[model samples]
Target chain A: MTAIAQQRKPGAEAATTRTRGASSGAAGGGRYATYLLPAAILFIVVIAVPLALNVYTSFTNWTGVGPRQWAGLANYRQLVHDSEFWASMWHSLALVAAMAVIPTVIGLLVAAALFDVIAKRFGPRLASVLRACIYLPQVLPIIVAAIVWGWILDPQYGALNVGLRDAGLGFLAHDLLGDPHTALLTVMAVLVWFQLGYPVVIFMAALQRTDPALTEAAEIDGATWGQRLRLVIVPQIRPEIYVVLLTCTVASLRAFGWIYALTSGGPGEATQVPSYYSYQSFFTNLDVGYGSAIATVMTVIIVAVSVVFLWAQRRHAL
Target chain B: MSAVLTRRRPARGKLARHGLAKHRGPAAWLVLAALAVLTAAVLFPFALIALNAFKPPAQYSAHGPLSFPDGFSTGGVSTFWQTADFGRALWNSVLISGCVCVLAVLLSILNAYALGIGRVKGRTWILGAFLVANFLPQEGLVYPLYDMAKAAGLYDTPLAVIIIFTVIQGAFGTYLLSSVLSTFPPELLEAARMDGAGRARILWRVVVPVSMPTIGVLLVFFFIWTWNEFFLPLVFLVSNSNQTVPVALGTLQGQHIMNPLTTSGAALLGVFPTIIFFLIFQRTLTRGVTVGAVK
Candidate 1:
């Protein structure tokens, strides 16, 4: 693959930089080759080869432990009929809403409130501290967040229920993670909590560059806070909004550690997303082919979503 | 600054003295109060972990979850570490993430040099490949890599994680550093070339030193990421001794499912390094969050 990629480079260079001959282009390519070699080799061995192999393996009937045979779309056919697969896809979409959309909206409000109102009224020091506090959860490992939240939601001695009961809200307290009906929503809530900081930080950073004069003019013109936020702040930070959306979209789709640590897709698969489902099918069930098919479909979906978002952004910009 | 605050102090104080309304209106106080509450809610879990980590079970159960611990005890913390073999796990994490940092950064510096400065042909394609590769979910790659690791006898070893993380991070590092280095002033490189410095020397002397700050930020991110990584380690390393910290804590959580004290202790132990890392490099971490979106 490296040789092929390298061989194709000079022809392109010769065409693009037309004044350069094939010999000099090859020499320039060789010079750059040494710089590119190590990353290319590692990328191929670890990522490219494995991904290619997965696409092939999806077509085969390979249990993880044994020899493989070409099954000819059997796995994909099984996925078409798999209720759990479709359910997980739905769950992922729900997570996208919970983790990406909801957080972006709330984060914008919080960050704008902090930067424009609180920072101005109180002090920058307080705002900085608050930003750090909000971002703290994001810095911790997902597994740690999962474990901490898992303990909090524990039925018997969990802090959440204990606090609820103490506060005389006993009727509201229940097994948030263990109940099938509430499990997925509960996980989504935790994810939203975990995700708020990313957008908050991103938006706040973007707001730092916002033209203060526009906001000042709006304020002086007796525009309401809501009006200023809608008409002034939001427009300045569109790119950051898109950034948060894309990052959180990928994050929620690939979210595993939290789900795995929190409930292990429990309460009878209520909280199971495709990532966890793929893990179960490939590793636990030893059905490598089925797992690979799920994984491939998931990859396609994620890439497709990304492309669509980028296209939308370009269109919006134009 | 003090003059402005002093001058505005009376008006702000008068607004506050009026109760709900303020210079900005009722929402000003409401938003501030709401933000304070949100900050508390966000920090509440960590506070729970810290407060409950050392509590004895009998005392903990008797006092209930919200009660302040009667006193400190290392018993739970010790138990968590011993059972989870956290010392081994911590060592494994350090070794693996350390290797990943070195390998990922080195490879990316070279690759970024090529793409960002070398202006190599097909640079855009190579860069696009790296960007797409970075976004490929781990689920899609883990199974095949699992098989490959088993084939190569690396499955359940630190080396497997090191190699995989290095590659994953190599893509990111390239994307980040290439953008960072691409912003390097062309005149400097031109001057170096005029002085007959070769590509390697120019990169090492001019580009590396000039880009060290960005590289440092990437290093911090890569280290925290690798240290906190849970999924790949869970899939790749099976044994207790070989498992990284997150994996070790995860195993401990499974075995001691009902023991919140141990879980809390292990959770604290698992996240301590990253907490320390963030506190130290807080600036860079925040910068990475937004600046990372830059092309």
Candidate 2:
């Protein structure tokens, strides 16, 4: 449905410049071009210039202090052998699994069930209410989500442990975020919870375009819900599935704020991701050059993934 | 169509003869149970925070972590406010998010107008840069921005956080508004120009009035994004008085890592405004999932 919505809108304004009379049109266009100035200036100062400076600083020994000395790929060389860099990279991969793969799979199942069975038999109103409930967490700040989970995983008095003990599963209770063995897994679970709502909402939007008659006919034909979802629903929502996957992957790549609040990349760096690691190197460790290197590498990875996703989408779309 | 089918079914007495309960009973139960559990999972943490925020510290520590408070009290919230200097933090956050909302929305109108309807040269490059900038993580720019802010004497100030949030959030706002504005009817602009309306007059009188709903949606999103923003504020604002709610809560977390009541209270303080905003604009937010995710 959204793909269709996107298709309906023309790509760019093609005739606005010439729609007016010829005499004053050039002067009018010049004045309109001035409208882009403020945004351009702000973007240049805040984003483009800083990013260029970041690349430049990665090659120097700038330590958040005075002048810089050019060290020429030394930071990149150090990053090659850096154990923490490699470890954080591994953590990011794990995060991609937790935040992207698992959420997409589960969100699809929940959304399908909601649309096919729940809404079909009951009512759309009920399904929407349920959708809103599941989507509640997405609107919250990531930092707040991490803090709430931090409280839940608090070793001494977390609700998670409290709930486990209350349910007579005390053996399942442990220092979820304090023990290195389970720290990363615990963080992953919380991040998964944070990401669950997004894909569900996206899929639900896509499902609006599905013909209920087809689902009803498939049902009368003795097709199980799973078969119907596989044979009918998934194909119809492939574009949205790609949308969720790409956006979630990009989100996981940019992960930092919440992880820092949750673990501070702690329990001996068990939950350290590239973004957090970069932050540590910059702010805490005061190693700006190495930090910039970590950041530049992260940016490259993100941009690469985005490019691949867009390329793939273009091919499939065409 | 489904409504018509359902209405005709009861008139035909098909429901009574067939007894729909045979098919709907177990399936409905299962779906309801699953949805109930999901709702609980999503709301449990907020329930915990709301419950714990009201408990006095002594009673909070005496009881189980998941236990309900013995009685409601404002002690924890007041104590958290004093402990974390949340008044100033709240003021700082309000100022930052408010300015960001206004600036981002205003700049987006300009940027979107130029790119969306003006047919300006290089519009493609400008839109592409803004869209790509939206995906670039703050981590990539944090170090350089920190240095730049410090050098410019804007470090540890609300103005620094405000400007950074404005720039970052404004980019997304521009992207969203441009998509919405690009669909504006060209005939309307022609009609306005035929009546001798200038560019400025047409923008405020025609474009803005027609796009108010979309602009309203962007306003809500930008405010929430700025208000919930953590990383940039953490990097830019270092002083106690300068911190936003989230950053202040962060600092308080490090200080009172062991105090659940205080931390939970502080967390509620940090999240209260966002919850209010979401409740007020819940329809817009839920509907926006597609726009936000797909874009």
Top candidate when judged by DockQ against the true structure: 2
- Cα misplacement distance, residue B4 of candidate 2 (Å): 22
Q: Model 1, range B34-110, lDDT digits (tens) per residue?
A: 99999999999989888888887788878776888888787778988888878898899899989999889988999
lDDT of 1 by residue, A64-179 (tens): 76678999989999999988888889999999998999999999999998898788777778899999999999988888888999989988889999989889999999999999
- Model 1 residue B160 lDDT score: 89
Quote the lDDT for B168 in model 1.
Answer: 92
Per-candidate TM equals 0.91, 0.90
How far in Å is the alpha carbon of A244 misplaced in model 1?
Answer: 0.9
Q: What share of the true interface contacts does each candidate keep?
A: 0.68, 0.64
Off by over 4 Å in 1: A1-30, A314-318, B1-25, B256-258
- TM-scores, chain B, all models: 0.89, 0.88
User: Residue B234, candidate 1: how far off, in angstroms?
Assistant: 0.7
Q: What does candidate 2's lDDT look like per residue over A145-245, in tens digits? A: 88888888887788888779889999998998889999889888888888998898899988887765555555556899789999988887887888788
Error of 2 at A143 (Å): 2.0
